[model samples]
Target: MTYNVQIKVMPLKDLLDPQGKAVMSGLQNLGLSGVEDVRVGKHITLRIDAETEEAAKQIADEASKKLLANPVMEFYEIEMIN
Candidate 1:
């Protein structure tokens, strides 16, 4: 079977996100208050042939570790759809 995989890569929680901060401040200036602690992340979409969700997850994990995320300072999440 084929599964659609989506991987989201992002900086660690404690890391600085200047882009997100700028957007947050802009939103506040536009009268959109109560929004805090914004962070930006990347999304990757791909297709994989796997027998089960677990297998798809394993493939996504390897891809994330090797290419999608910077292991030293980044975190990642995976979503799979069949």
Candidate 2:
């Protein structure tokens, strides 16, 4: 069976996101003062062939840990899409 996987990769909370900060600064400069605590992240979607949902999830997790995300500065969450 084929399963759809969604992965979200983001900077660790303790890490500094220069791009996010720059975007926030740009927002403020554009007069959008209500925006605060901006952060940037990546969303990835893929399809995998697996026998079970659990197996699909494991595959997605492994992909995230091994190739999709940077373990040092980023973390990833995987979701199974119906």
Candidate 3:
């Protein structure tokens, strides 16, 4: 079977995201107010062939940990889309 996986990688809460800050600054400059903060992140989609959903999830998790996300500065969440 084939599984569709979505991975979201984001900067850790304790860390400052320069890109996010820059975007927020731009938004404010554009007169977009009331936005307290912004955080930038990456969205990854993967198609994996596996026998079960759990297996696909494991594969996605491993990929996220090994290559997708930087553990020191970022965190990742994986979800099975199908």
Candidate 4:
């Protein structure tokens, strides 16, 4: 089976995000106010070949922990679309 993978990688809640803060400030300057606690993240899309959905998920999870995200400061979610 083949699966389309969608991964969202974001910094852990306790981590500080300077880029997100900057964006929030920019938005306020643009007249969009009252937005607080904005966080920045990354989206990764890929395709994986596997025998089953479970296998695909495992592959994505392993890849995420091993290389895609830093387990200490970041977390990841994997979505498998058939």
Tens digits of per-residue lDDT for model 4, 5-78: 99999989998988898999899989997787799999998798989888988999988989899989899989
If both were scored by TM-score, which would come out higher, candidate 3 or candidate 4? 3
Q: Clashing residue pairs, candidate 3? A: none
RMSD of each: 1.7, 0.8, 0.6, 1.1
Clashes of 2: 0
Query: Worst lDDT window (10 residues) for model 1?
Result: 73-82
Among these predictions, the greatest TM-score belongs to 3
Q: Which stretches of candidate 1 lie over 4 Å from their true place?
A: none
lDDT winner: 3
What lDDT does model 4 reach?
0.89
User: Residue 77, candidate 4: how far off, in angstroms?
Assistant: 1.0
| TM per prediction | 0.82, 0.95, 0.97, 0.91
Distance from true location, Cα of 59 in model 3, Å:
0.5
lDDT of 2 at 55: 95
The 0-to-1 C-alpha lDDT of every candidate, in the order given, reads: 0.88, 0.94, 0.96, 0.89
User: Residue 76 of candidate 2: its Cα lDDT?
Assistant: 92
Global local distance difference test of model 2: 0.94
Residue 63 lDDT, candidate 3, scale 0-100? 97
- List model 2 lDDT by residue over 38-71, tens digit each: 8899999989999999999999999998899999
Off by over 4 Å in 4: none
